[model samples]
Target: DKGELKGAGFSFQVSDAQKYGQAIGHIGKLTSGSLKVGDAVQADVDQARRQRIRLNHSATHLMHAALRQVLGTHVAQKGSLVNDKALRFDFSHFEAMKPEEIRAVEDLVNAQIRRNLPIETNIMDIDAARESGAMALFGEKYDDRVRVLSMGDFSTELCGGTHASRT
Candidate 1:
């Protein structure tokens, strides 16, 4: 959500924020504005950019699951970046991925994509989410309530991002 502050300062909204803070509900960077606390907000969306990001984000999850399947359960995601062009994933691995291992991961992700698995989302207590076997990123903070994203029976993780209804 975004909006302009109606005043002499002429504050304009630049972009929406993702993660919430303790004091700030939504923290967005301003391009040219002098916004203050208690400013009213409105939803502003760029449909095309959002669509591309969604695709990349969902692909990141798929790749995460495929990595575990092909590599090992010890594989833990270190970080990830998703943009309109691609999704870059960094993970903890003992050694460089072998060619066959990389190909196997690709094949697994492709097979799931071909299946067109239904994407399911549910809001639940954080503890319940963990009990449900949802994979969560280490060091990431979670509230009492969390959103769980499950890709068919293939992947289940804690995420708060746009995703397609199907794989």
Candidate 2:
């Protein structure tokens, strides 16, 4: 997904011996500079790379649901990141998962994938989504309007990321 170098991450109070500027500017916005605000920035992503990432991203969601079902309802995703090579997921748990539990989660996910459940995306009120028992990431802030992704009746979550059309 790497594209043009649209902006730089700069810190004015760096520990280095010298300072480049007195103020820091945000991407697509002017913090304190002569540059005009709302500068148009365009980025092009490699389609093949994007496809791989999307596959991994969608898998991450299924894995989360599988973990919750295998481990316990207390399972909550702490963090996650997916790339072409791997999908890393962190969740809340007191102890390491047993081998059998891990295998069960894997089998469950494989079965779901084989079923080819259609992935549904919809925009709805955050409160309504919550009322329907859709799992929301703990401690994450959400606005009144949110995107909900449902992988059939297996998993439904409030997500804004891109996902595959089917499992």
Candidate 3:
């Protein structure tokens, strides 16, 4: 009940950010603090960690494109996790990927990475984005206005995630 700030170096650790209706909320854990109504606080992001996350997120997009090229156009992103350390991508496929197929996907992504292609982002109407050939994740909900990210001609998708300036 008391608005007491404890600990010599108390800080709020934000774990997740979500949108609820028109408002955005950050859910987190407080080390030692009693945050009541109207408690003002400052937020800061770790730039280096954020950079790593961006790199991983961009890599995920590139990998998705490579998978579709190597496998088939039927390949679609099922799920994905992008973090500072690594990226895990799940997709739809008829069968397990062969070793050579894996290598080909890796090679394609690596070649694009070597090129250091610049990443471009645009916000447009959903229909316009789709008409421009931006791939959207199946069964995923999107706003009327969407963010389309493209990396040269290698990859283009509807994404709101942070990304590196170049592959």
Candidate 4:
């Protein structure tokens, strides 16, 4: 029951051009000196800033697992937004998660606080990732080469998000 469900397509159509265009537009806007607004950083984004943001995002995956473990068995990711200081995860569940559930989720996430698990990245042919048993997210695609991000053995996904070197 824990294995991946392969080749199941959603009923919706996604526009690849629109997705790439939106990504490019955002990058352009950030580089256009409009990102910082009134902040002290003043629209300056460097490698160090990116790495710092990645550290927080790595925590978000743990958050997803925590939610699933506490929230019954119906949770499925619906959407998300990730930025420098914070990370947001959205999932499919008929009812709202209860307050107690939220606390339980947080506590579970916090339990991994002191563990140090190294994160690893592999760039291999798409076939390699599938053959290696990586969990492919719904509605995701892979080219000839895909990037696999892993947190020890906790979670391994084909993603384009910032990440921590280790957990």
Candidate 5:
């Protein structure tokens, strides 16, 4: 991916480095952070990192709830990785959904901002969830038990994430 970014730079507005060598500067200056692509380094994640992780985790719940309301009950949280930056949600659907469907999902998600639903998370048995009609993803591997997160009746899913007090 770094190479891909570098290649794009060669064809874009910043094509010639020598042309503006005096006026502009090195290409690295245009980028963010001091960590280059191949640097042998790692960033330590402390308690501050955990708080950021929690915010991202909670936002994911909001988004998941929104998608199900807009899409369908069939929609399930396929997988997720949340951090300070943003939420990446994957769902269960055989084929790629239409643009209208994607937009509707996004719109419904934003609309939740108006409803202030509180997030409630609890650990329970997977069999109990299935008995209660709690939806699970298509190919999710699970143990005998799982965590249930309920954001009003607006969203109820089996998730393991930091929840918001809104519930």
Candidate 6:
């Protein structure tokens, strides 16, 4: 591979990435030029976009704790989607959330956000994490060692996602 600038203003960006077996695949669109299998290239991440993603990811943890407080301990995370634009958290709940309940949850989350609690992450055995009351997603398998992310005493969960340094 030649150390050459292939093209400028080519509007090429990685739209999606996933892992299959032991390999990772980057899916993207190239506006110009053809690339051979071994062509060398540099990848730059948009730091601002990544910051937004971290903020949203951390917010989800706060929201989860708020939901449990307001909607009862039965609330369990079913799924989640986190990106720079937004975070969608799905959880188990029987009835539609009333407006007041929604507002209460928002207030609780906002209060924590205002505190700007420092985020802490620790790697420990899965059993120890469970004993520490770290919430894990149902039906999800985890290795013997796990990451336990905590935001003060308010929230703690088993997570492998990126998070902001503070609430």
Best candidate (score: lDDT) = 3
**lDDT (Cα, tens digit) per residue for candidate 3, span 3-51:** 2233335666776666788886766778665566566666665678889
Query: How are the candidates ranked when ordered by lDDT, highest leading?
Result: 3, 6, 1, 2, 4, 5
Cα lDDT tens digits for candidate 2, 1-167:
42232324321221112123655332332233232347553343455766887888999889999999999999999999787688999999889999999999999999999999999988999999998778899889998988999999899999977788899
Which pairs in model 4 have colliding backbones? none
Tens-digit lDDT track of model 5 for 22-86: 37332323343333556553322244556666767776777776677666667777688776567
TM-score to true structure, per model = 0.79, 0.76, 0.85, 0.64, 0.58, 0.84
Candidates, ranked, TM-score: 3, 6, 1, 2, 4, 5
Q: Model 3: how far is 130 from its true place, Å? A: 0.8
Off by over 4 Å in 1: 1-18, 22-44
The residue-by-residue lDDT of candidate 6 on 19-43, one tens digit each, is 7766866667775766765666676
**What lDDT does model 6 reach?**
0.86
Candidate 3's displacement at residue 156, Å, is 0.7
Clashes of 1: 1
- Off-target runs (Cα >4 Å) in candidate 2 are 3-43
**lDDT (10s digit) by residue, model 4, range 7-120:** 222111111111463362122211122222343331223556567568777887777767777885466677776666677888888787789988998887777655677878
Q: Which TM-score value belongs to model 2?
A: 0.76
lDDT of each: 0.83, 0.77, 0.87, 0.63, 0.62, 0.86
Better of 1 and 6 by lDDT: 6
